[model samples]
Target: AKVVASPIELCQFNGISRRDKTAQQKPMIEVISSTDFQVLSCINQIKQNMFLQFPERRLIQYDCGKLQTLDVLLAQLKREKHRCLIFTQMTKMLDILELFLNYHGYTYVRLDGTTQIVQRQMLMERFNSDEKIFVFILSTRAGGIGVNLTGADTVIFYDSDWNPTMDAQAQDRCHRIGQTKDVHIYRLISKNTVEENILKKANQKRLLGDLTIDGGSFDVNYFKKNNIRDLFDQSSTLEDIVRERNEYQQKLDTSRTTIAVAATKTTTTTTITNSSNPDSNLTLTQYEEALAAVEDETDRRAADELNKEVRNE
Candidate 1:
């Protein structure tokens, strides 16, 4: 019988990104007997499934759909001589990924909170110089900043951070100034799960970033809502999640377009007021044309799928 693996749903937290702190740490034997997956059963199931699928030469069930897609992407990218940087939030998840890499005979280097500061630089240097190393598995926070890994051209977000900027910083590791090849970044988000909601909230925060960059006076409180219960509750169906994502995107796009128009008008007004020349109707007309073009592009994009990222395999 075939086992369909679901993407491991990580716990949602406010402010700091961390694993369940209240979870009791226990021996393997104790954990095995416990039904609490928060401790170790989740990773155990993944390893068990990997062995189950070993004889078939197909690593289809890796206890998560994200890993299945990564399995295919890794194989294809390796053949093309493209190195990869895989980022996940939890170090335990890194351990699970390492197990998968070892089982598949893929050479990799890992860095997380446990790695010594002196050894972290050494590992980075080794991964950068060694063309034989196919992947660099890293915990998102530890490897996210103050590291340059230009050797790899592809990046995969095994799981996204609650804060969008953290994920963005992690992505910049491979897409920085020293990189030559076109960098490709992928974020794996499980559909119809808590991850979908997390992504939506993250996107909203990103939109706030865009607004701040555009010099729009938008209150950060606009995105905040008393919806924590909705985020963790799994009663929402697939259609409900999709609709929410699309509706939210449309609203965000509309707000962006409005902000753009306001900024354009403000700029045009300031220029007209300061300039000695009065025939600045041309400038206003030009701004109107640019705004129209932006609106048209936004409309075109709004018609497309909201969640372009793939769900669990």
Candidate 2:
């Protein structure tokens, strides 16, 4: 039986682009498991859908929608002298935010994947300690990588992420322990499109997480189950399925081996020590082992779908 893959590339985009490539010429499309996607992918797709829907306003400014909302919120926050964290999925979008902040003459700092290792800590410290800096523009993932910005009481998720946990982690950059004032989170969603779909998926995932944590039952995907036989003819024998599965397994094994070797060579050891000392004094070695165990579990879970497909075969 053939499994219909969830195509990563946006579909129903049959219009022609004004270039060598036609709109019909789609990007490399393939179904990736839920683990392969992050919130940023949905953000990019929604941005594409917006421009696709509104072809006339190609030169329109970026801040017309969320920026207006941002202006009103920041104005009030400035009056209260409350610092804020602004996060976007796309770095180019971060550039737009930089422009908006510059237009308003708001002193701000920035952090992204490109920021140098030495400069990141310095930048975070300045944003936290400096009174002049009123805003911090950050890439969603980069902001939460290593630095802590608890000085900001308000967080603006400049865009939506498909994975709800990603946004949640970014929001906590300010709302975590040692935060004094009440924290506020604002997620800017486009009017309608894949973004709204992403929001629905995110909410469902959030509900699932809550249910699991609370000892309740939940379904990951809300779709109805169907039999594998529906995808193939009745004449297709078990041997044919086994051969197809074996060939795919061999290819996957090769890919996995290559990836594992590359990862092993590039992986670096980082130090982690629990300083809270809240009664349990877990040693650095033990902490590292526990972290490794979690990492292993995450890797296995990411590959669980492949394992399940094999078992079905």
Candidate 3:
């Protein structure tokens, strides 16, 4: 007869040790000049440590980085007979990484937003039990929360989201209560890149920004007082062009909409001969249309104001 596991039994089986050193270890900075080199060196070091600690077995981590670094890291991990769980932010990146890893002769599994709910559970089960498969590349946003990656001892942030809470949640995928070993987190931030500046800004905000904002208003004064100009300066290569084009396009569209709405409003108000009986003459659709026109006009004016603000910046 087949056996079914109970929730209480499963909880006991997956419980983490109170004595886990990884829980107590202070987070350290492992800086390197290049993201690629940092990832390579870190993978090698993790494999060496794994060998010393568990020579008869292998362990891996979730990596979210470029295809090149991931390829090199996977090769080294496989050479040491270790398993890996890789994560990426986008499905496009995941597809590219999957192709590259497969091309390089690695046995791996993947889970992304496209994966069905039922299929995700099956994949997770296979990853936990399979001995031959060495890596699981998942989308961080899709697989970062409510997953049991206790099979992994290390977690790598190949890239980071602007929000630090997301990063913390992603890291917790392996650092949870069931983890037995020291959970080593390796965050790869490219020097002088946007990711580094984002990290600095996120650090200044107590390492979490998503929780601090409410109802569209945030503590902008805190960021201003902190003088975080350097954080916003690391704009991407195409940032200026994209920003300029988008701003210009938004202004033009707003202007056209505003003009059309104003014309309609003027025509409606003129057609309404008696102001005292405006409500009687106006249909619900007409009232809604007028309100929409006013709203669109207000939006256009706001956009113009924002354009001035951007110009000053």
The lDDT of model 2 is 0.62
- Extract clashing residue pairs from model 2: 39-162
Candidate 1 local lDDT, 1-313, one digit each (tens) = 9975433323332322233334333455576667565547688888889777553333433567988888888889988999999998666677678778887889999887666668989998999899999999987766534579998999999887656877887888888887889999987878778887767666665654554334433334322223344567666655664677677678778976776677766653211122333333344235334434643342223212112211211
Model 3: residues >4 Å from true position, as ranges?
1-66, 207-229, 232-313
TM agreement with the true structure for every prediction: 0.58, 0.50, 0.47
- Which candidate ranks first by TM-score, i.e. highest? 1
The C-alpha stretches of model 2 lying farther than 4 A from their native spots are 1-63, 213-313
lDDT of 3 at 244: 51
Clash count, one per candidate: 0, 1, 2
lDDT of each: 0.68, 0.62, 0.57
Candidate 1 whole-model C-alpha lDDT, 0 to 1: 0.68
Which run of 10 residues does model 2 get worst, by summed lDDT?
A: 222-231
Better lDDT candidate (1, 3): 1
